[model samples]
Structures are given as structure tokens and as C-alpha cells.
Target: MASGDAGVLRQVQALFGVGTVVGMTDAELLGRFLTRHGDAAEVAFEAIVRRHGPMVLRVCRDVLGDPHAAEDACQATFLVLARKAGGIGGRERLGNWLYGVAYRTALKARAGAARRRRHEQKAAEMVPEAQAKERNRHDFAPVLHEEIGRLPERFRAPVVLCHLEGLSYAAAAGHLRVTEGTVRGRLARARVLLRDRLGRRGVAPAAGLGALASSRNALAVPAPLIEGTVRAAMQIVTGRVAPAGAVSAAVATLTQEVLRAMTMMRLKGITTGLLFIGGLVSGAGWLTHHALADRPEGQQEGQKAVPAVEVPDRDEGDRRVILGTWTTEIVIPRAVDGEPQPPLRLEETWVITGDRIVTAQDEEALKVGAVHESVYRYTLDPDVTPKAIDLTEPGWGTFPGIYELDGDQLRISYGVGERPTEFTHDDQRGPFLKTLKRVSPDPRPVTPLFATAPGGSWAIHPDDPGGATDKLTSTIGGVVLLTEDSPDGSLQVTLAHPVDPGAGPRPEYRAVAFDEDRRRYLLEPTLGGTGGSARGGVRVSLQRFRMDPEVLPEEEIAYLGVEIVTPGALLMEADRAFERAEAAGVEVLPPPRVGEPFEFALTTMDGEVVRSEDLRGKVVLIDCWASWCSPCMAKMPGLKALHERHDGGFEIVGVCFDKDAEKAKEAIESLGMTWPQVLVPDDEEVRRLWSEGSMIDGLPRLLVLDRRGVLRVDCAPEEVEEQVVRLLGEPGQPKP
Candidate 1:
């Protein structure tokens, strides 16, 4: 996983000492990696991830036989080593040490699993059945994490590093600080325990082992897991993760929706019936709009100037109706500056498609190249203006348009026409947004079968037996089987995915369900009679009123809890950090306000303590910076600029929460930061804070504090400088 995301590579490059190229041999690379990103041993350690991710993952799969589980262990194993990259003696021994860490992590994971099983057993006895089902769903993945924890430290570590991670026997053994022979024996034992787990869960040797083994290389589809990827992704999601396999199932459902859409696009064949409905969009218009000068032909001399045309509002929610489909020709004009540019005249190729209006998701969004079957579920947003939309129909994608209500007929331009772009949901779904204009009655629409009833409800209809059910459920003989709840109801659906080790894997299904009308249905999940997570398949959205759509949707972000590590530890371990802020003697106000979870200010300045739990509505920045971090110290002026400009909306608090506090203190003192700073304790509190409060993947991370002590950001860091300056506008009237 780390190997494919390019994150580790990016981090390594970013952390590399100036002038160091990545072409060095493993030894030279590790050495430089350690020297440069040493404190950030995690970055350096990724070298190991790149070097051994495949093998380590392979080893874990071989041992546990559950690819996903193996990956979990693999991630955990690397996390442990990252914290101790320094302990790795020489280049040659790196492999050995990695294996050792993997072994230990595996054992710990197994032990944790045992503890969870015990806990689950006790809870099952006490909880009611319905509640229990929900609890089971919620507890599955964590239980898996815990079971991995339960394995004896020694055996578990090697098993994960070797089998799940695909490390060679010798490499895993070296990393675990054990003999290769020991690794082999422990792997054998792990298999035994795994088989026992399978037997307890009523899975066959092939089914159980194959189920886990399939998830080993989740990021990229290795040649072998391709078929398994399709089926396993489908099965794991619905079976153990959800109910019916999720990934493939969801994708398939999406595909079916697309297919249905395409079918609709072709049905409403173009006819003069389309033009009769003037507002309706005809196919691509072959005609060109000749710009006529104000002076009529031969009326010589500039007779008069043309008045500016007023653009209509897009947020009014009015839409133009399509008359029919047309293929209008768009001729690009000659460029005055250089090469010929694509013509500004856009064309809307519409066809009276089947039962639904098929549209393009603006093939021009990216490079105006060949379209990549883009599709979207079109919907109208009563809250805000919507932007470009894609049709869920496979071939028919929606084009961006400026639509206006012109009496009964809707008039519109297909491309950026005459209006500005509308608002879109950018954070969650990829960038391209979708909003529908209530265009003149769609020139081409078929009788609807799934139209929402009054009050936004999909009335349940009889299940069509022969009608291919795109919503997949579990089936027997599947290499992997899972069941997930449908968002529409509590009804359980089963999914069975068979694995063909020859094919690689991809997330083609979704083991997710969510209630559309409201968050009504309670759901649960179970795998092998135990519970776990189906990753992000189940996205629970709250009722509209649960959050302020205007402010929060744009400003709120659920703290990711530092996803860098596994249940990732050490990732948040802010042992020691330094921050150079404001002029040395800048007046520092009270600490920035912090929300719950990271309640404590974690004061360590003897007696004079600052804890987040103790402050509210105060502005501050809890800087988890490093002394060696030039960027950390360099951002001082900006932090100062923000502090000085803002009346008291916020303050900046530098929490030298680095692994080495002494060094940080030296820098802070030398820099003469007049503002108050806290030294984090070296106890469980620090670890807890790392794990819970801040998502400290790197230094110079600025968390802007509002009066409510919440973090808000409108864009990425590089692009938000102006926003930050605005957020810290000229000093305002101070709040008493």
C-alpha cells in the first residue's frame, strides 16, 4: 500500500537532505534518509516499506491467509520499526530487524485479537439481539485489529512481517531478531491458529485462507490477484466487512445505473418534436452564431454601441427545458497570440435519449481529449447552486451549461456559456461537482420507476426475480462471503466473491449502505461470527439539521486521528518539536481554544500548566514543531502576522511535543519567543495526545482556531495564504 500511493516516496524526497538524489544504493539511501529525515524516522523507514512492502505483505498472507488482515499487520509492523529506525544496525541487518519487528507486531496483534474476542464474548452475553447486531458490525474490524494483537508478541510479529508483508524468511527473521528457523516455526504456528479461527467460523480451508490472502496487495492489483481483486473486493466488502460484498457490488450498482442511463440516452431519438420544445437542448448544433456588427450591412461608420447583455442568475434554481438533441458544429477561431485555440463557441450535443436525459460530465474539465466515460447521479440542490454534472448512464455524460428559465421554454448554453460556475461538494467526492437545472421539461424522459415520492422516499416495490439485482448479496461457494446492511433498511444482504488468484484486485464493489431519507435504520456487521469494519463503505450522513449546512459543511472536518500509522501509533508520537514564532518579544495572548478529545493542555512548565481541557473559546495554535525543522522556525513571521492582526479570535501555542524536548527548549529560548509554550510530558498522556488530539504527520501544520476552538480550512495550504490573511484580518473590536 505504501509502495503504491507514492506518499512514502514523496515524504522521502521532501525529507531528503539538500542535493541528495534517490539513486543511491540501499545503504547510502538509508544512511542519508536517516540523517535527513532522522527525527522523522517514519519517512526514512518507508525505505523499508518500499523495499519490503510486497514481501512482508506476502508473508503475512501466507501466515494469516487473510490479505486484508495481513496488510493491517504489515502496516503495524512497519510503524513499530519506523519508531526505531535507528536501532537497525547496518544495511545488511535492516532486513533482519524488519522481520523481527514484523514478527513482534503480529504477535501483539494476535494478542489484541484474543482480548477483543473475550470482550466480544462477554458483551454478546449482556447485549440485546438487535443492539448486538449493530454492535457486531461496529466491532468487527477493531476486533480483527485486536485479534492480531492477541498473537504472542514473538510469533505474531514475524508472521505479519514475513507472510502478510511478503518478506523473505531470512529478512523477516532478521527483523524479528530471531533465527530464520524460528520465523518458519512461528509462521507454521500462525497458520495453525489461523486455521483454527477459520474452523470456528465455519469457513473451509480454501474459503478462509483465500478470503484473507486476497487482500494482501490492496493498493495495486498484482498480476495474480486480478481476478481475486474483482471477486474478493466484491466478497470481502459484503461478506465480512459489510453483508454482501461491497466494493464490486457498489461499482456494479453504479455500472447498472450507468447502463440504465445509456439506455435512456439512446431511446429519445432526435426528432422535430425536440425543436418544438424550444427550451430543450438539441444535439450538437452544426450552425454557427455569426457576430453581427452594430451597423447593419453598408450602414457605414460606427452607428451606435451595443448595450451589455445582462447574465441571468444560476442560483435561482430555474432550469431550461430541452427541445431535443442536435449536433451543433463548433469551429475554433484562429488564435491571435499563437497556435489555434479551441473555439469559445461550445456545442451541446443532445439526443432525445431513452427514459432519461443523458449528458456529459464536461469532457473539457480535464484535458479536452477523448472522454473517459464520465457519469454522475444528477440531482437538484435546493441549498446552493450546482456545477457540472455527469450522467450515471455509461455513455451519456452531462456537459456544463448556463441554463435560464425563459417562460415555458428554458434557454441555455452548454459550456461555460453566460454564467459563473456554481458551488460544489469538493472535499468528499472528487472535484467535478453536479447540480441539475430544472430545465424546460426534459425533451426526452421515459416513465420513471424509481422516482422519489413526496417527502423523498423510495417506495418499496416487489423484488424483480429475473430483473438482474445490481445490489449483490452473499452466495454460497464464494471464496469470500460477506453481508452488509442496505442503507434503505435493516434487511441484511449477502455477497459471495470467488477468487481467481490469477487476476489482481481493485475496489469494484462497496460494502456500504446508508439511509437516504434520514438516518433511520440501525445496522450491524459480522465476519466469521465476529465483527469488523468495511473500511469507508458505510458512510453515515446525519440529517440536514444535524449540522449547519452553510457554515459547517464548508468549515468542518472530522479530525482524521492521524491515519499515518495503524491504529497507527508513533505516527502521532510528538516527542519533541520547536516553533520560531512572531518577533522574539511579541505579546502572546491566551492559548488557542481546543475542543474535546484533546481536552488537556498538557502543561509541563512545572506548576504553570496549560491544558486544552481547561480552555475554551480562546484562540491558539498548538504547534507540534521541531527545532531542526527550518520551515517550522521560518513560519514564525506568518504565525506572528496572524497573531498580531487578529484581535483575539485566536492565539498560537507552541507545544514542543517532540521526542526530544530538551533540543526544542534550547531553540525556543534562543529564539526568545515571548509567548507561552508548553513542554509535553513523556508519559502516556503524550502518546494519548499524539493518538487522539493532533494529526501531526509533519511540522509547520497550521490549525486555524475559530472562536469555537474548531479547525477550519477553505483550501489546501499553498492556496490558503490569502484566506489565512483574511481570517486574520485587521484587528477588530476585542470581545470582552
Candidate 2:
């Protein structure tokens, strides 16, 4: 490709002006640059650097915070690209791809910097940059950045490519190897979550955050940094580089995985030939195994291989044990539309062999046609406390669960992501648990029931007859119902909760049923709610619908009644469940309460200790807020107004929840908040108190206190002034 480029360069120069590179596509320019190694190569490389330098700098700056570090990271990023230029295909969106590499590079740099600071005995800090104008700007930027970093890699990669790098949706999708629609949906969901979180913190979503996230705020790369990067790139091309001390600082920072991804992107023409050869060489047996390998799926790669556990030799007694079908109850303690929901009795039938365990819905599940069955190849370690069991499913990966076996009853619990260490079912710490009792003899074969059963309108009844089931609405087959094949070779049924099409997808009840398990058609249905603010704030009803197929024929019923799990109910129940689990010594959030003694020592942004006891005998207004909270920032003017209005009688103390202390300090100084504010410490106790306590689920919360050091009123940002006035007027011991 680079054999004869001097003549081509001269011809291209004659055809187009120096500035006419703008008219040429990235692919065309890249092609020219690849073929020409002398002056033409330099010009093409310069143009590419100039075009993408600002974006690369912006990403590094956002992640690294320090300007010096950002510049170094930026140069290193471009250098890596230059070294891999031959591998980067002409059709690839080099700019977006560089953004991803920059992100990982910046992260690695930050981690290294943190380790250095930790290891250094003496503080090497110098100028504090107190007067830096840029430091004081973008108060919410830190919060936005932290949240973006916390996003799952799948979503984060797209966001970084599209928003930070300014790539179009299609371009971003291509770079990430996903469909454009998938990119759009993920971005939409991510934005909703960000908006909801920001709103909860009292920050308005429109506070230039959306604009700043895009490339519109790209910071220019300094002349020296660009020059240094170009020099480094040239050196790298000539193979004149040495490894630095740490592994992170090595010249070739790109991992083999990243190199493979780059190769895939560029290997368009020869992909088929390469794949055929690569496949044959790698082995057809390995390919066949991987073809059936379960998909590693999660919000992140939460799926991990469970170590192969060797079980004891099977005996007659062991084979007979846990062989029959069983049933259990599942209850999701959530609140729908501010109302608590009743416990749901969910049943499941288990069929166990020497080394296999299969679960399906009982005969009662047939009322709702679709049910999901799960089959697992399990190895049980009976000797351990809370007997450990490793289950491997064909296409869904493996999970580690705990089980307790008795003569006739068995209890099992499993979690979604990690292995369950305990056998509890709390919302936070506990995994989903099932308690099953073996039936005396297997019932009739359920396969015949599926064939002979009359199909029509059928009512769905909960096992718990006493619970309220009025709000649920069920239908046989329509927009409301969907059925698919379960992983366990049973029918998977999903009964949708009645929802306004405008609100988007909410929660629905799912059931798994086996056509025939042993002698009975196993069916088990569970009821729960699953909507959140992501679907907007529209609240729906949570009512359980009665379904009794035994009493009335399926044709007799005009419509079926199924439980509708509302979002509000789900959220409420989740809190209650978490609290319950925590009380049982589970590692859940610690719930804080109002009217409790307000005691604690906090260091102000200026590094001064301010204890609650020290502020005794004064009318204190404790402000809980964060920089990312748009509403919190909006209320700042009003807070400042209040502080100025009643400085003598009232004392305002701000508690900032910003993860970055520098960002919090800057926001406070920029807003001109004279009141003493303390950055909230990231301790477990503090985190739990804030998360579980109703006093701080959302930000911009104001707590008013009397001079006697007793809690007065817990009010919203808008109502703080009125509440303070009332507290000030009270006849409690006046400030001495």
C-alpha cells in the first residue's frame, strides 16, 4: 500500500488545494496518509490530529480533572492511535474510536495518580489553584461525570462515543458494534436515569448539563501538547520507544482485546477468508462448544463461571431424596401509587434426578398458558453449612445458590448476579428464596391437560384468597399477554399490567409452566410490580385479580383477572423489604429518622470542625444538598436570601453529597454561600443513613431545629422559609 506514494502525493496536491482536505472524506484522507510516508503523511496526520484533538482533550480533562494530567493523557491517547494507524481501517470512525481509547487511558492514568499519592509519604501538592476561573465553572459537571462513569460499560461506551466524542447515533452504533436503534434506546434510558437522579438532587435537568455533555464544550488542545504528541507519534512509528516503570506506563498500552477489536473493524475485505482459516485452525470442536455456550448477559458482565464442584458419588438414598415436585410462596413487598401491596403466594414444582434439577409451574399455572421452566445440571456439596449448590444452565450461564434439605421439605435461594451467601429473601441483601414441600405422589400428567383444556377467557386467581385482587386485569391473548419458550423447556408467560401506552413499558407478572412434570402439569405464578420514575411519574393501581379455573370453565369467564403490580407499590415494598432484611443483621442500608438526636462532627469545606453540639442553643437549618442537584442549585439564591435575612436568629449549615470535594467547594464558593457547609463523608454509616433514611432520599431537604436543640420541622426547599419562621417564633429557650 505504501510502495509508490511520492508521485500520487504530487498529483493529489495538484488536483486539490491544501485546505481542500475538508471536502475529502475521512476514509479518503486516511488512504492518502497511509500510502504517502514523507511530507504527505505528515500533512494528513496533522489534519487528523487537529480535527480530533479538542475532543480527546475534553474527555481526558473531564475524567482526570487536572489540566496537566489531562494533557499528558491526551498525548498518550493519540500516540497509541498513531502506533496502531496501520490497523485502523479507512472506513472506521477514528475519532469515536479514539474517544473510547482515551476514556480507558484516562481511567488508567487516574488510578496510577491515586496510587502514587497514596504511596508518597509527604504531600507533593503545591499551588492550590484557588483563583482558577475554569475550576469554579461546571459545578454539576463532576456529578454528571461520576454518574456517567458508574454506568454499565455497554451504555457508557455508547454515551462516550456519541455524546463526549460528538459522533452521530449511527456512527456511535457502528463503533460499538450495535444497532442504531439499540444505541438510541440505551441513550434514552441513560438520559432518563440521569435526569431523574439530577431532579431528585434538586438540580434542574436543563442547567446546560445536556449541552456540556456533547462536544459543544470541547476544550482546545494546547499547541505544545499537540506538538509533543506528534513527536511521540513519529518516534513510535520508528520503533524508538522504551517501557516506563509501571505496567500502565508501558509504550504499548493497548491490550490484546482492544487490538482484536481494531483488527475486526479494519478487516472488512479479507474478513471471510480470515474467519474461515481462523475458525479451522482454532478447532471445530471448540467452535461447536462456544456455539452452545450460554450468553454472558447482564447490565454489565456480572456473569462469571462457577467453579466446577465435584459432588460425592450418588447412592440409592441420594437419588430418592428431593425427587418429587414442590411448591412455595414469593412476596414482593412493594408500594404501588403510595399504597402497600399484599404478599404474593407463588408456587413452583421441582423435578430432581441424580445430578439434574428442573423447575416448572404447577397445574394451577395452566390458567395462564405461558410459564418459564428452568433446567439445571447441579452439583451439591451437602457437607458445608448452608449447603452450596452450583447450577449450570445451557444458554444462560451458571449461578451459585444455597439450599437446605430436610426429610420432606427443601428451601433454596439464588441471586441474580453474584452467589448467594445466605438463605434470605430481603429486597437488598437477600436473594429470591423458594420453599418447597414434596407431594405424596405425582399428580396426573399435565401434557394431556394442555391438549384437552378448553381455551378461552380465563380468570387468574392468587393462591392467597384473603389478599385483595381487585386492581388486576387479565386477558387470554391480546396486547396484554405474551408467551415464549422457557430455558427449562416449558412455556414462559408474561401477563402485562394495564398501562397507559403513553407511560412506556412498566411491570408485568411472569409465570413458568411445564407441560408435564413427573405425573402433574407443573405451574407456578408470581405477582410483583416493576415500574419506576423512568416510566415518568404516572402512578397506576396495584390490585390482585381472582382466577379460579376449577370452579368455572375457561369458556364461561368473559375476562380474566390478573394482579397488576404498580411502580409506586414496587418502590415502597422494596424499601420495606430492605428495612426488614437490615433488621435481621443483613448488610443493608441503615435507616435514619427525623426527631432523632442530630449528633455528628463534620469538617467544613475550609477544613474547620463544626459539631452539632457546638451549634446548640441556636435555630439551625440543616441543608442537605449536592452540586449535581439542579433544584438544589436553583434554591441557592433563596437560601442565600434567607441567610442574609435572618442571620442573627437563624443558622444555616449545608451538607454536600458531592463525591468530589473540589467540585463541592467550587460550587459553594461560586454560589456565594457564606453559611458553613460540610462535605458529606463517604462512610458506610453515613451512606446508609442517607440512603435508607426518609430524611434524605432526595436532595434539597431542609431540617429546622429549635434553640433547645430539638428537631422542629423537616421541610422542602420551597417551604424552608415558612418552617424557619415558625420555628423562630416558637417559645422554646431563646438563644442566650
Q: What are the per-residue Cα lDDT tens digits for candidate 2 across 315-348?
A: 6443456555565654334422223556444466
> Top TM-score: which candidate number?
2
The alpha-carbon RMSD values of the candidates against the true structure, listed in the order shown, are: 26.7, 28.0
**Which segments of model 1 are wrong by more than 4 Å?**
1-182, 190-607, 610-619, 628-630, 640-650, 694-698, 707-724, 730-736
RMSD of 1: 26.7
**Where does candidate 2 stray beyond 4 Å?**
1-20, 121-162, 165-190, 193-215, 240-373, 376-736
Model 1 alpha-carbon miss at residue 5, Å: 55
Worst lDDT run of 10 residues, candidate 1, spans 286-295
Across 466-488, the per-residue lDDT of candidate 1 in tens digits comes to: 01111211111111212221222
TM for candidate 1 is 0.25
